[model samples]
Target: MEQPFRVCIFCIRTFIHRVLEPPDDVKKLFQDYSQNGTMSMDGLLKFLSKVQGQNNAKEDDAEVIFNSLKHLNIFPRKGLNLEAFYRYLLGDLNTPLSPRVHQDMTAPLAHYFMYTGHNSYLTGNQFSSKSSVRPIKKALQNGVRVIELDLWPARNIKSVVLHGGNNDVEVRHGGTLTTSVKLLKCLRAIKEFAFQVSEYPVVITFEDHLTADLQEKVAKMVTKTFGGMLYRPEIDGLEKLSPESLKKKILISTKPPREYLETQNSNSPHKSEKTSEEQGG
Candidate 1:
């Protein structure tokens, strides 16, 4: 039913005419709570606490809600009629998730569900599309926490992030026509928009295809771009890392290059970086 007008537009003084038609069950419920065709404060409080599962709802909460839902200056803060009740059913008041964060923030990173962007560089196709930092910026702006970047050596000595770099010789979409975006541009984009939507940590997962030298360049680029915002674990294992502790931090997620690990193995007697690994929850 499109525009189910309950009252005349010209003669509307009591409540705003409901734009949506209510179902049979909703009408029955509205009538059930109605006393003299008006849902009173006590009725609303009962509906909220019992039917809506707002267990902590009290008299003042009911009054505040009742006052907010009534037709503003058109009606006094007395009760909710069918129109007001229908509006309440369609409004932001009825929600599954809390409007505010109510859970404990002091938990491991893995314990939480984070927004992740897959193939964060590519703008379109997997095989032959131009990769850009715009999508990364959009993802960050939308509160994405995990961003996946496939890092590869550019034609020159610079580094670039792209998709479909599965080929051995060239960093392309396996030999297809996928274009690439510069790593510096992606990092700068991340740095600019990472914390705009949220204060929690942002994880950059690099699908590394660069050589040892390019890896060093990438290290420099990441460090310079993020600066003090980068998260470095104080202890060897990140056992106690939590969302509360890592507020407004950018984190790195990638395996060290084999060339660098081999160099470490040859330089020291112990296995060093190779044998060192930690399990986190």
Candidate 2:
């Protein structure tokens, strides 16, 4: 038998108290550097260096450290606010405590850990399961930033989302299957629950296998459902957008046009080579 993991409420409460109400020495240190409720960058560097036991720290070393802190949004352009400085020292400055900082947005896209959900519309196993919009609602409420939508064309209906298999396009686990959920219902649920948890953007990864007419319907549904919240390169232009810029927006990640894919392949260094052996020759 397996034992369930449990959280220690007493430990959590004690930690929260320590964070919310810092020790006297920590408060005294903040007071020492604070001037008119703010501390200059130079003063902050001096304090940090001293705390790290780097006595008589060089100017270059201090500047490097300051740059890193600025990246974390710990220091403002001129100085640091008293409360913000305290939060930084206590290490509760990002996300659940506050909005993501500029540094968090400006980092390379590959660096961030995207909270993702696979087959988001399924309530149970894929083989035999009931499809429902509730899973999307719950996942978004829990701060999932990326969701997968598998689209297929239906006979009587337009388009629906489900895990594909030898069986019909319905929600199912290994062998068990459930009724299919409409694509529109899932989209509406996504729109409703997206910003409830976090102001961050939501990405929908579409696995589309639909007829041309059904594909058009899917496009129309997305436009109608998301409206102004949709991220369109035509409207915003083809510039590198940061996470901060995309807050409260819904972005769709799907297969690119054939021409676009061809262009990308043409640009590859080994485009003409058939294989590693050909390239070497």
Instruction: For each candidate, give its TM-score against the true structure.
Output: 0.58, 0.50
Local distance difference test, each candidate: 0.75, 0.69
The TM-score of predicted model 1 comes to 0.58
- Candidate 1 colliding pairs: 164-173
Best by lDDT: 1
lDDT string for model 2 (1-281, tens) is: 12234457543322212325567886788778767767776777678567644566676754554455675433666666655566666553222432334456754345577899998988887766778899989999999999988776443332322533212232222223455677777888999999997887899988766555556767877899899999887664535576777889999988854444677798777865656567698
> In lDDT terms, how accurate is model 2?
0.69
Stretches of candidate 2 above 4 Å error? Answer: 1-103, 108-111, 155-176, 235-239, 256-281
Reference-based lDDT, residue 107, model 2:
49
- Candidate 1 least-lDDT 10 residues: 164-173
Query: Weakest 10 consecutive residues, lDDT, candidate 2?
Result: 165-174
